[model samples]
Target chain A: MSATFSAQDPRALAEAPPMLSLRGVTKSFGAVEVLRDVDLDVRYGRVTALVGDNGAGKSTVIKAIAGIYTFDGGDYRFEGEPVNVTNPKQANAMGIEVVYQDLALCDNLDIVDNLFLGREITSNGLLDDETMEKRARETLASLSVRTVSSVRQKVASLSGGQRQTVAIARSVLWNSKLVILDEPTAALGVAQTEQVLKLVRQLADNGLAVILISHNMNDVLAVADDIAVLYLGRLATQIDAKSVSHAEIVQLITSGRLDVDSARATTTISTGERSGSESTDQGAI
Target chain B: MSTVTGRDLPGLADAPDKRATTALSDYLAKVRGGDVGALPAVLGLIVLALVFTGLRSDTFPTTFNFANLINQGAGVIVIAMGLVFVLLLGEIDLSAGFTAGTAGAVLGVAVTNHGMPWWIGVIVCLASGALIGLVIGLLVARLGIPSFVVTLALFLALQGVLLQIIGEGGQISISNPTLLAVMNSNLALWQGWVLYVLVVVGFGAVSYRRMAKRRAKGLHAERFSVWGFKFCTLVVLLGIVTFLLSRERSVNVEATSIMGVPMVVPVLILLLVGLTILLNRTAFGRHVYAVGGNAEAARRAGINVANIRLICFIICSTMAAVAGILIGSRDNGVTPNTGGNQTLLYAVGAAVIGGTSLFGGKGRPVDAIVGGLVVAIIANGMALLNQPAGVVYVVTGLVLLVAASVDALSRRRAAATGRF
Candidate 1:
């Protein structure tokens, strides 16, 4: 659907344009405010894990980023440029995709069909099955997906892990620059979780900005390069995942503060400066 | 025609097509995998056929009865074909029977009362059917009303529309010669054979072209042997049907010699092929399945699911109109009872019996044709044996129940195997 399988160099990503930066993003439903003054920064070649407690506005932030909800007030920037995305289609058109936790996949359709669901390739008004099949195979192969035997196997016949992989792969299929995943591992087994988390890291490693929302701090700490925590409808801090500990993330999630009134306390966004634990998490991913 | 019959040998390694033995085993494995596409319908047809062949019907064994079976089943088959669209969307059109009746009444009124040409009447009838479908579709897709409830309301309302069209004449006897011929006439014996040849050759040409195209792309195509066997089997089927239909079906050879395939056969075939292509080959068809399987997913994929649902309803009511006209032409009149659940239930039964999943996203138009045959045979055989209408209804109902059971149980089996 895009130009070919071109991945930007991870090393060059530091100098690359910023993928998505939200400044003072606010959302409300009638009288109740869900999110207020939320500042989030997602960069290329990095997984920004957006972890929060239940109803801590993590979903609201994701929906807002995916253009499922309109921000009551905010500046939504894409690739260092300002743009208003009022719908999911606009987000998709801007190379932004949100893979919801429910995994919005048609079980009756095969991998190829599912991948090209609304955007089927047509020649002479008929589905160009061969071309689509070839591209699906190429994409899956590039992702090193081996669990699936055939591209024609229906989504229903796939394991939870494979389905998750297909869902993730679909976002990249369209040359997406920023992907927001919501609770991807909540229903998956441990092995599938590992597989998904790896796929998530690979997305970032391939120079795409990835936003992951999960309740599990372990998953967030293991693969994320920048972990953004939200608590009580506000972003507490966006810290370098490498610099932060699992307890720090948990503390932020619970209390909406990284540290007690000392250094690196709150509302500070950190960069990917590696640490002792960060290298191990990188290897695990 | 079956989408379930394929191997998934991972990446670029194109799995070679299996031989006949492997193909057979593969089919068995597919059945075990809860993808029993049309097996039940085929087996049901055979069982019903063998039982009726030696039963009390003097005409059931005749070539005339064989031809009669086609005519008797054509209307239901067409309706069922249309129903496949709605069913594929996991939606129901309960008013389809009456929609057909209302549309047929429009034709009858246009031609018989207003002295319009048959073609104009046909257009008017079809448009009316489209309008009816549009209304039902709007209610379901736009208003977010359940299709079952919306159609049920139309089912009652359309009956009144038909009654209003009949205008206390009690019935409208079709006077147009062309309209009458749709159900009463037949193709010449030579024409039937020529059509058969053309169909076979066309199928071979289309299939081989597709295979060659895939091969050109360095992609796996169905094996020549596998496709050859399928072609041969289809040819044999058409050959038998043409040969059987070409025989002298009239009691007296001179008066009304019905010795060719009925015109309805071609009509049925045209609908079958067109709808099949629409479903299996087109983007619209693919989107329909997507919407049915998971609408939220389809919406995220930027598919206009509501539009798809609306179109499917339109197709259903329009096909139902065609069926109504066919039945009206066959009966030579549009009576008050011209459209009823007797037909809708049979068409639904035919669809389900042929393995078109009521749950949607797992059906083909061919399923309707096969299932229609099973329903027709049951009805025809029961009629020939001097069985009352009650028996026919009961038997048909039981058959549908069994088919639905198979569907539900297989769905469960599929879920157990993670095909859910």
Candidate 2:
């Protein structure tokens, strides 16, 4: 695939405000390039949907952002300042939390424990159970997640949806300003998908920037504020959710090339005006 | 794996505003959570006692026999207490036997040879054990060697050292008056019984108060009936033990005031209690579980996994050393072969039988005590029956098998139930 990016125009886009941004991100596994010149942005209170075909670098982008992997040629910026995230702990320290697909929960531990995990609050050299359980319950309640009866219930006893909620809640619980979710609704039933989508939207509405990596187009459409489509190793386009339709995004996902003629034809500039537009577009065609 | 039933966690979320509970309530919550695993063991003890009583009739119920049982069981119980922590992390400490032997030899050198104060020698013994633990921890964590290998090496090396220390002699007899006094002398029978009662009651009371605090703070309690039942059972058991030890000297026996029970019993009990609290209540304890449960996960969570493992090995080795010293003190001497043969086997067996999973992350110091008692009882009972040492070994092996098999089966069932 050709590098369709206009190099000069990227400087202007680079100046745009970003809550979290990756510039010139490049990743390679041996000789295969997974992510090449990938530039992405997430704005505060906005859900940026990262959609791509399998192996289209969605995971690479998310992992780099979450500090699961270090990209070779990228400047990662949080709040428009450059930062190097060497590990997940570093990412967490910088207010970046990643909720992976498996959720990484201890089945034997209760909701409060899973939420706190490694960051348990203790006093007098002992686990402060009361304070932890209290904070856990309050956090869940604040998130409006009422499906579960209590925070002390073990995560193993929860349904898939409730587990997802716990996972997401845990990532966003402690001073998090950015949350990255990978395949949040991949295995969920209809009701569960609805619950998780609501949570994603809720997270963004709560003033946190959310980077949602999903393969489900419909789910993305339901929760995303701005949809960024990645084709091959490069980001093809990012369109306002209000301006794009599911079918148009799907075309961008499958073919990488936009059907400009069809998009223009549907906009109703008139048949005679369309003919006039084709005359100007003839040189490029 | 038992499936996690929602019913198992009843009222976890229903408790409204538990954080507002008093300090007493908070303490209660912790005690309640810690004691959840002890009920089954307690029940097993009662049933076993009743069954043995029924089967042996005259022999099992004899007062002399009961005292003998406590005396013989005390040493093993101490060893098991230390082994429990090692097992809790799903690790084993094979060196405990040799570690104990080494400590015993050191005590011999300190008291008999150097004429050090018994107290100073005791301190040195414990310090030596802690140092062994530290070495084992470093080997396992920093050197990236497995604990089994590290401990096994220590076990062999320590055994050799103990033999050399004994200098071809089979035993190092203790002649220190103070040391002998501790091992052989006892308070008035009634006084000893009273002291035991007070200690047991004190702990039970602390446990009760802690549980009550947790309940007040809106944390889950192990059913109100369960806590009451546990408390009542403990009281009854303590009463029986104290009563048994308080029995009058045999009618024909000369000293009507058969001095108080051996000091080993209380020391063993205290060690078990202290270790249990340390394993379950402290941040270090939690880190141990985290590392055992999943080292990678623990590391990702910002825990220093290597450091936790290192510390655990150190603790385990140190405990082993303490156990050795206790054994030597109880016997009033140290021997070249004191900790060889079945010592490691029994330590591991006691730990396994006590219900600490070989898989780690789910066990307690109490389990080790129970398991050690079980082993000691078997040994004492066999000796009473005039069974040979070989027979005792076979029986112990079978008992260990049974314990391990039962644990495996129960865990498998728990997993199936999704209660993991």
Candidate 3:
């Protein structure tokens, strides 16, 4: 998995510019500052994994990027130009789409309807069902998604993985430049998870900047080109996935920072004893 | 890494191979899985007809009785149709009855007292209804007030307004022959036949065009046999109704031909068709279902959830106004008691009985028609048996309970089976 990351160091690739970059982004609700001085960069044609423990403000960062919440203070640069996105509509207009964790799909509606919902294609004052269905099929086909039996099948009838794929496909359907997927595989089975991870890789390969928010270390390690770790409302570090080991990432997540040599020394000592107590101590911040 | 297969790739060619269940079996499975759409209502209608036929064979199946039954059902049907929209959002409008009365009162005051043209009065009534709905919608959607509470307040307030408008006499005779003809008149036999033919042909053409479009797009379309069966059933049903309505029944041995379909039936059908199109084939309709299904999801999708809720409420109240006009026409005037009593209850009952869910997002416009007919049949059958009003009320209550239970049970089944 690390070999895949080494084959493509996303930051070193100068062909695609950074699609979105945030510097000194701060957000607070009342007196509680959820995110403070968070800096992040999402480059086009690259998969950037944002991973953190609970209450680490990973969601706050993604929400800020998706424009679900306004940043109290920040410089938001989109493709080398500074921009302010006050709402989801403005973000959408700027070609930034968020595939939320909940999937945001109507269970009663069919795939065709769900895919073209809110922006239905109408010809001569009536819904052009045929055209919409055809477009939905074409979009799914482009993604190589073929598990769905029919476009007319309702979302409720779909499996967790298929629903995730449909949601992801919907975001990209509107000519999205940056797709932020929040825990795309959190509720999926193993096979479904594999399919979603593949689709995520395909999105980045298709030259769309992808920001994946996930808790699964394996998923992040397997697909991410650059892994950005958040710890306690602050960005601990952003590092290339190939250069880091599992214990190093864990140490960074739990303690907000990692002394690489000390972490290696601790790992070596723990391996000899194979004691759980020492491992826990090593994880402590 | 595992190789991709049809199970993992939904758009693959082999995906269809896994769906080996034939269309007929699939449909049967859906029915068995408790997706019996309007079957319960249709079955109830048939059973009611049989029971009435067994009890009062002489009068129950007569042309005049059936016509009168439809005429009486028309107002409730219209109201129920409006209620379906509200119910689809898992919301209730307790004020529909009084809203109807308010519109009727407005119509009466404008046309009779103020000497406005009947059409102008109708416009005022409809506009007033929309305004009332807008207010309730704003209170419910914007202020976050519960619809039950808001509509309940409107129910009381509107009833008082109706009473004030009618005054001590408790009635305002319309005196407009044109308005009275809306519910009291019938289409000629030829006209009724022509209307039925036009409807049948229109439906057939639409079905064919849809199938052709699907086929052309290489999508899964309904089979020819399925379409034919549906078309034939509709034709046969219309034929039987036309035949029954065309029969002339003698009044007091005077051989007075009170024949042909009631004028309101065709009007109701037109409204039903129009609403069905709006609900099924429009972007606004899609947003409505989306909001009803999951408001949070709809909001995230950039749909204005509050706006959708407001529009649905407006549709409900506007429909109530239309029903109000029908009620006034049927009674030949507006009375203080016009939309009081069990009218709102009956409308809610009809929508639920026809399979609209109380938990929002799982019903169709046609449910109103099916449920409305069921309520009407019960009332008509009871009246034919010379049953007291108390008995009618009890029976209606019991049926509503049964319908609601069926809805709850079916929802549980759908959830258990993982069917939407």
Candidate 4:
């Protein structure tokens, strides 16, 4: 696996114009603050892995990114300009697609219908189902998901892995600029997991920035170029995968203890960058 | 002993390539309790006919008795057609009986007491019924009240209004000669039978052609053999009914001059066919089913569920009003008791027994007519047997329960097995 480095200054890296960037993102549910002053950068043609343990606020961060839950404070910038993602539709309109864990598909509907659901193509005020089905076939083929025989088949008839493939293909079909996949291989068989990981790598190689959230350390190591660990709603450390060992990442994720060398590595990479002076040690559980 | 394609073949008569055919045959075999409710209703009618024939011997099979069945079934058929639309949306209209009565009473006053034209009065009455239906629908949809509660209130309120409209006079007789002549007119024997045949043929052709077109487009098409069989059977069955009615004593009294079937039978038949198409083929119809099947899912799919529901209520109420005018015209007048309490029961019972699911998402106007005939046959048979009206109620209730139980069981099985 190849690792990515931001090169001595995270703020300077931001000045280089990321494909998408989040700055000063904070979220709270009622009285409980979940995400505290978090910042991240996603550049074109790179797979950025967001890894954390359970209750590390990874889901809340992704949900915030997906517009499932709004943030209390944040600056979301796309292509060097600030943008506001107030809802799923707004996020979609801005070319940011989130393929969540559930996929939110209607099983009774066929693949073409599910792919174009809520915004089906219409001609003369009636559904242009023929054109939609043709486009759906092309989209799946573009993703190299060849297991399906007919796009007209109902989703209920599909296997679990095929369903996931269809969902990923749906997001990509819309020309998304950034794709956030939540636990893409969480419930898959070994072979299916391999298929999804391959698809994820291919997605980044296709020039779109990818944000992969997974608890599987090995899978993340296999595909991610950069890894950001969050411990108890705070960013513990962000490091290049090639520079950090699996044991160091586990420690940083679970204990918030950046071993001497790994801490130096973070300082060396983000050297003159403004460090978020928040208490990462508060979540040292 | 029968092992041609396999070693110890177990009922595998055809090759593996014939699986689609086998599946279709299995579906057809389950038609009585299949996804379509029409099968069981048809079966119930046959069983009821046999039981009645057995009980009354010659009287039940007589031409006069059969004509009486048609006469009694016509009003109920019209009202039940209206109920099917309401029930298809998983809603209920309890005020149909009273709505019919109120509309009839108002029309009666306009035509008889105020000397207004019959046609104008009927239009006003239907509009009134439609307005009431809209109000009830709005209350149910907007206020989030249950449909049963909303309609029940309408039922009680309309009953009071109907009584007040009729006043202490108790009855209002129509003196409109043109209206009476047109509504009471029947076709001559041969002409009546011809009209029924033409209607059944016309309706069957339209249905089959549309279904075939849908099938060709890779959409669902009912089994061709089943569709053909149903259409042919209906034509023959209607022909027999017309023949029976033509042999009645009234025909001989008119010196065989009026050889056709009653005008109301064709009218009811046309209305049932029209409503069935309106509910099945339109986008609005699909939205209604979606709303009833799963409201949240329908909303997420961007359907205007509330608007669909409101339109359904208006259709149901307007249909009831139409039925009311027809019934009043047939009886030559309207009274405070024109649409009695039994009318509501008969209308709802017809819809339920005909295969309209009380749970919604499944129903047809044609099923309502079949259910209406079932109720009418029971009443006619009981009267012929000199049995009490109470017996008719018991039998009808038992049939309704059977139909509802069958529907519930079928739905549960469909959910479990994931068939159509």
Candidate 5:
């Protein structure tokens, strides 16, 4: 990365600048240091997967980025400009949106209402239902999400995958530059998972940076262009998805250590037994 | 970035309500699926009206009784309408009855003893109700006290305040002609017709424009024929009421002519329209539903849930103030028991009977009116049958129980079907 910018505004920097970059971020709860010196980079039009074991500070990293919990120490930068977002509203203003695991959707409301819960379109102090309904449908269509019948259907009647679609669609509804999805496909079925992963890919394809946090290795490897692994509140490695094997990721996740020789040896055995049909779109790469 | 799939899955059951026979069948499907809405209340109202008419044909079916029913039920209906807000948040205000009583007492003391004008007394009364609601809201929203406990405490405390306002065993006769005119007066025949015309035209225009807008967008909107039917029904219902009310209903037309629609009808109608619009077409209303449905989700969505709860409580109490004034107007005096005894229960009964779910996140101002009529018709019919107040209470309680059962049962059915 260059040290100097040609443009006056850091936000107007050249094409190579990261959409968001965090360096040496640390957080503590009382005497316990939950996260220590974590560095991560998210780029425009790419899906960066953040993977870690339970209690390895995956949520902490996300919370810090989402501005749910302020990091004790960090250089939190967005578009090369140092930022100190103290609340979720500020993060949203900086074009950062997080789709939590719970989706935070009201079951009693319809898809359109849920999508624009707090931010309703109004004219003359009255709800502009037609305008909101039109935009909601367009947003869904843009994501190629046709799993639900109508935008007016209540969320309570929607399937798990459809709910996830609505939740993801809600995040992208605003002009967000970065979206952090926590376990997007954690509770979906086989067919639904494929639909969601493609959606994740489509998000990046649409020029929005996406950070996907998941425990599923297949999902991580299948949808992520770059994988940033965290171990024990610290950065284990940030590597290209193509450069790492399944066993290598497993090793990094478990021990927070790298053994290139052993990883290369297990690749042959792992690839031989893995189903080729399951990886058709992935296999082309 | 990697293995991409979707937009090609044949497994999705994504069928829009775009199929043939969907208009009728879809309604049937929803009804079967436990979303019966206000049908039960309407049917209950119809059945009760018929039974009461059959029991006391000469007295019950008369136009005078019809007008009487409207006046008698207006107070409870308005109170119930206010309760709808608190009820929408899945909260209750048992103190609503006493809140009305307290407001009535305040109005009485202000106008009678203090020589305040009727409007000033009204403003003071409404303010007191709002203040009482604020206290309840603070305990429930800010302090996290359960609404039932806080309102229950207020219910007992407000009665003492009521007794103190009018004094123990003291009753203040409200001789302010303007205030008394609210329940005892009637609009002239021309005025009634004019009001009816305004209502029907206003309703038709709004509905037609909304439908036109939706249709213009190529979105799902009711068919013209369907809209026509609904519009025609409204016209017929209002026309019949106005036509009937315009006739002379006085027992002795020589001395007094008590014809035309009661003044209370127009007031109730105005309240109904305003509150309906407030609940359905406003951001604040949506937030109330959202918070009621899932407070955690609403909180995450950046909605101030506590504020919504606090406001709803205030609305409920303010409504209680209006109902109290109606009661005082009807009785021509303010008494300690103006909003005491079965007043709150009847209002709650009327709300539930109108199909406002006690479980929350469902109801309308119209529901209160419908439920109020049901309660009023029963009382009126039973009184014509020479039934004691005790018997009337028992019967109303039973009907309320039936309405509640329908609500709970329909919810279960809806859940089972919603899961499908």
Candidate 6:
């Protein structure tokens, strides 16, 4: 159900600039247009959950933000300044980090090495393992990650949740401003899912802009401050997570539109007509 | 995703003294989890030594035979060290043998035909080797061709080139005394002991410095006992080997007493130490492991994966070339088949048997030494027993198979235990 402040939310006040904003972002593969005129904003200190059904262009939108693919026609504004980010390296230079669904991590390397994979700490042309290990330890500690027994353990030894946390920590280790997580909780167990969700919330709470892409409604509702729904390569709606109900979000996902009156009427009819359905059902049978 | 606080984990608490216990348990757990490392190779070495010594009591462990074994194993060791880099990246160089052959031919032609100095011949050999490597690297890295195919093609083409350079039945004899002395000559007794002492002291100093530095930084350093154990092992091993090499091996009045460590042994040791540092302590080495472990992950981390692969290929070929030079010196000439036939296979076998994985991301330079020695010992011991060539081949093949099996099984075990 839409709330009273659904349309007049103070987030739209435009007093402070959004942390990152994309306007009319379009991406096409040959003749197939995957994203069309998409507009989204990731505000500071907030979690923006990007939710959509399969093949709904959610991945395309995040990839564009992650600079894995350049938008065909759009303006990418980071902190209200237009910037060109054609590659992940450039995106990282601008403090944009993406933790992909695969959690790209070297399984043979230790946690410290994985955290500082490309950008290693070196002294006198030799790897400074001490500094890297110390920093990795500090980063994990700051995130309150306790599942990992030791930072020197190979990634192959870590659990799925621990790997996800390492990936998350790695993204934010280099002063990232916008951290994007793709299906972070999809493969995790319940306890691990809860831990990851808590970490995601903590990321936003620490004044970082976190874009969480997930299919689980409960997880999104629990951690996300705002929900942006994508329907068939188009933005269906952007709404506050607190104002949306499960049924309403489901309806929006399936139909790409929200009919408040019809949704409410359908639920009421289903519940209220149960007692009267006995005689009508016998007659129909 | 469970929300257990750090305090909830008993052993994970911030206890300063628990670092040693955690490290020790972690190491034990790793071993139990199938990260047996060099243990298989070490045990294999001991068992082989015992068997061979029992069979040929007069020659197997004799000072002369041991010195000869080191000399023969040195070429394989150097070549296998290079293969370690390529293997670490989950790639192989099938052309290493022929590449070494070509290098030897080039050196032979330069020193004999062109009358160049021995050092110049060495430089020429290395450059040609590097050039060969560069071409292969470009083909593999830039063209995205499979390394197996690229190296196989090189293997065939290099053999042809080597044959053409040396001509039919044309073997160039090595005239430079210094070049031949690498494997033929032995160090003086005093000099041998001096080098041994320096190596032990150097290793001790470096280990102590690194441990101190790690401790000062409040990082996870090795336990003092572990360090001490390693130091003691090195001293004892080096002491025995050096003592054996320094003894005289005079079989008859006509034969001069050949005593002291072979010059090639020290050179091989130096190369091993250098490569160990490169692989374990440098950024490039770390990148190699990363690329081998997961190329996509390395690329996503902004690493130039292709570049790393290219450099590794170059290193492999160049080292193959060096091995060729050593072989030529040891043989006193460069034949057309210098590095051909079973040379490359033996080098690969040495690396794998020494504990370097064919699957990659799990090997060290020390593997070359250990594995190469095993290969050498088998060939030498079998020869001493007057065994047929076929038997030697069969035994070596079995060893390689067993090593590969060990690698595969341990990998599966590690996967099962959720560690590697």
Against the true structure, what is each candidate's TM-score? 0.92, 0.84, 0.91, 0.75, 0.92, 0.92
> Cα lDDT for residue B284, model 2?
73
Give one digit per residue, the lDDT tens place, for model 6 in A1-285: 111212344464223467798877789999998887777878766789999889889999888888889999978899899988888878889888999999899999989999999999999999999888777777777677777877888899888998999999999888888899999999999999999998898777666788999999989998998888777777666677877788777776677765557666443322132232222222221
lDDT of 2 by residue, A27-77 (tens): 998999988777777876778999978877899888888788888887788
Report candidate 2's fraction of native contacts.
Answer: 0.30
Better of 1 and 2 by TM-score: 1
Which runs in model 3 stand beyond 4 Å of their true positions?
A1-15, A27-37, A72-74, A262-285, B1-21, B253-255
lDDT assessment of candidate 6: 0.85
TM-score of 4: 0.75
lDDT, candidate 5, B1-420, per-residue tens: 112232332323333224435667878888898887778989988998889888888999999999999998988999999999999899999999999989988999999989999999999999999999999999999999999999999999999998888875589878899999999999998999999999999999999999889777656787777777789999999999999988899999899989888988888988999999988899999998898778888998889999999999999999999999999999998888889988999999999999898888888889999999999999889999999989998999999999999989988987787621
Decoy 3 TM-score against native: 0.91
- Over the true interface, candidate 2 deviates by an RMSD, in Å, of 9.7
- Candidate 5 chain B minimal-lDDT segment of 10 residues: B1-10
Q: What's the true lDDT of residue B62 in model 3?
A: 80
Q: Write the per-residue lDDT of candidate 3 for residues A1-285, one digit (tens) a residue.
A: 112322465555534556688887889999998987777888877889998899989988888777789889978899899988888888899888889888899887888888988888998778999888777777787677768877787788789999999999898888788899999999999999999999899887666788999989899998998888777777777767777778788887888666656676533322233221223333345
Computed on C-alphas against the true complex, the DockQ of each candidate is 0.40, 0.24, 0.39, 0.11, 0.27, 0.34
Model 6 per-residue lDDT tens digits across residues B240-319: 99999898876773768788889997888788888999999999999999999999999988899999999998999899
Off by more than 4 A, model 6:
A1-16, A262-285, B1-28, B253-255
Model 4 DockQ class? incorrect
| lDDT of candidate 1 over A90-189, digit per residue (tens) | 8888988888788899998998999998889999999999999878877776665767877878899998899999999898888788888988898989
Docking class of 6: acceptable
TM-scores computed on chain B for all candidates? 0.95, 0.86, 0.95, 0.87, 0.94, 0.94
In model 4, the number of clashes is 7
